[model samples]
Target: EPEVTQTPSHQVTQMGQEVILRCVPISNHLYFYWYRQILGQKVEFLVSFYNNEISEKSEIFDDQFSVERPDGSNFTLKIRSTKLEDSAMYFCASRSQTSSYEQYFGPGTRLTVT
Candidate 1:
């Protein structure tokens, strides 16, 4: 079975630097999403993309964040300028048309901004 894969399970970065979190979503899915969770908080949706445009984005997805499908299989999230509050577990998810509302999440990329 195919699954979402994330790189650099944990990362520590300076407060003003940049970071790129990578993900390989399930091979046959059409919809993709990014979500983040603070240490003890609920998962908060960041953005959802389909057909190369953003379908929806939460208030948390500010100008500092961007996402791209660099290729057929790779999806990436880039934070242009990191802040201490940016520390969290970033999750990548995908769902196919057959099951658009049910999402399968990656193990997650834990980013530590200090």
Candidate 2:
């Protein structure tokens, strides 16, 4: 079975540096999304993309964040000028819209900003 996969499962970076987290979801899935969970906080949606354009985005997706599906295979989230508050677990998910909205999630990338 195809499952979502993420790279650099653990990341340690400086507060002002850039971070690129990568993910590859199921091959036939169409919708992709990014969400984050702070240490002990609830998961929050960041953005969603389909057909090479963003379909939805939360206020958290400000000028510092971006999402890309550059090659039709891998999806990525880039954070510029990371912040201590940005330290959290980032998840990449995907699923087809044809049925229920159930989502398949990646193992997640834990980002630690120091």
Candidate 3:
């Protein structure tokens, strides 16, 4: 079985600093996504990438954010400047190349911004 893997399981940063969070491959998946949950808040979709371009994005993914696949097997999300409001648990997810219409998620990386 295959699953997504994220690095820097926990992060603490000061406001205005940059941050890059990473996740690994989910073989045969055609779509990838990033979502976040602020403490005590509902999970919210941030962005979705497919074919090396953004397929969809929420207002949250503004000028401060970007996504990349520096290598075919890994995907990353970069935040240009952190803000206190940016603190949250970020999750990476993917949908397989099947008809089930299901999306699998990685455990998540928690970001704490001061």
Ranking of models by lDDT: 2, 1, 3
Q: Worst ten-residue run, lDDT, model 1?
A: 93-102
Residues 42-100 of candidate 3 have per-residue lDDT tens digits of: 99999999999999999999999999988878899999999999999999998876749
TM-score of 3: 0.96
- Point out where model 3 deviates above 4 Å: none
Which residue runs does candidate 2 get wrong by more than 4 Å?
none
Candidate 2: clashing residue pairs, number:
0
Choose the strongest candidate by TM-score: 1
Model 1 CA deviation exceeding 4 Å by range: none
TM-score of each: 0.96, 0.96, 0.96
Overall lDDT per candidate, in order of appearance:
0.94, 0.95, 0.93
Clashes of each: 0, 0, 0
In model 1, how large is the Cα lDDT of residue 48? 94
